[model samples]
Target: MLYNIIFIALFIFVIYVFYKKYSKKAKTIPPHWHSILLKEVAFYKNLEPSEQKRFQDRMMQFLAEVYIDSVDFEIEELDTILIASSAVIPVFSFKEWHYPTVTGIIVYPDHFNEDFEFSNKSESRRIAGVVGTGRLEGKMILSRKALRHGFSNKTDKGNTAIHEFVHLIDKMDDNIDGIPEILMQNMNAIPWLKLVHDKMEAINNDKSDIRAYGGTKQAEFFAVASEYFFERPKLMKRKHPELFKMMAECFRVKF
Candidate 1:
């Protein structure tokens, strides 16, 4: 009887702790953030008012759950809103969703390289964003310049933040080799790889509109193609029908 009583008490204690931790994430978003989203993010701006509310809820939930830190620059409201907005855009189709694999976000003043150096004097600082690995697992690092640039160039169809987050989604399946089994369960790896290789050939030959970097490999192809898919769905659908169809199905969206 004492053992049963102890076990029940421990279970209740765990539940209480969990509730206390997550309940704080449910607070309503601030009023001004809506204006920021309306002004800056094209993805958010295009959403229906009702869907925009849902997007705001999810974006605020992301801000609450995931901590954002800056390495050098002061983190601004635009920085936080853009980062959280990037995180929300990819997973918005899911009603109740958050990045379990991402622990936090670190924003650098500029691009960093493989050595993770971001000094202004260094020429090696070329990478825009990266999903952490090894000791830095479950973390994301972004270049403030690249992060803002992603949104500023609305027609480019390249968002470093979204690119990295797609990598995180790919990472969630424990294999970041390209296929996100969690998101693309309906699509098998073989066909996906085949499609990736075909498109990569086109990119390498300058015969495709998909980004050149996607031609690097299967994983990059997934992320790059996803950037295009989300950024300009109409163009992608009109230009690359098959790939867009796959993307729409993978994201579980009609468009």
Candidate 2:
């Protein structure tokens, strides 16, 4: 009897804490939003019915907490869902995960350059997304067209939003090194580093199937490889089994 009472109390406390975390309480995911998720979001649609509800609740919570605004283009409901979905996919296994580094998201109508200019006339406008620093800290800017393109194609095995969000996750330990100390324990550090180095060599030598950008640096490698992991889990596992396992451990989820 005493144990049962204690268990009930603990359960209630957990629920209360979760409720207090987001007191703003997001509105229900509208029918239109449901349709969008069902049709557009492969990860959400593939989840079990109960898990899909959980995913929706998290999406609503994110939408409530993180304001998505447009710079020069009108964002559709689909765009909003895509942004939130990108944020959710990486940390979905954690019940209380949040993007502490991101305060607001600014979406440009198209690609931008180092100066944040997105006009098509600029030949140097090549950047797809960037996490802010300096005066622009606590903000993330993304190309709306690139954002849509990330999800539109599954064959490329890349998602710019996911890549950027993984960077945020990589920064949680206050270090932007390719090694995510938060996700990687001290014991696994050497193996993870060695594995990263070897794979980077393959990428640099044009022998690996991973993207070439990953070979540029460890931080970029982690983000780029994360994109490949989430977008094409089966292919990654079949080709790079070790990297696949480490990524699964890092995200605490496997597709």
lDDT of each: 0.88, 0.87
Q: Candidate 2: where is the Cα deviation over 4 Å?
A: 1-22, 185-187
lDDT of 2 at 228: 94
Per-residue lDDT of candidate 1, residues 65-164 (tens digit): 7789999679998999999999988888987776778869999999988888899777788899999988988789999999999888878879899999
TM-score per candidate? 0.90, 0.89
State residue 254's C-alpha deviation in candidate 2, in Å. Answer: 2.9
Please identify model 1 stretches exceeding 4 Å from their true place: 1-24
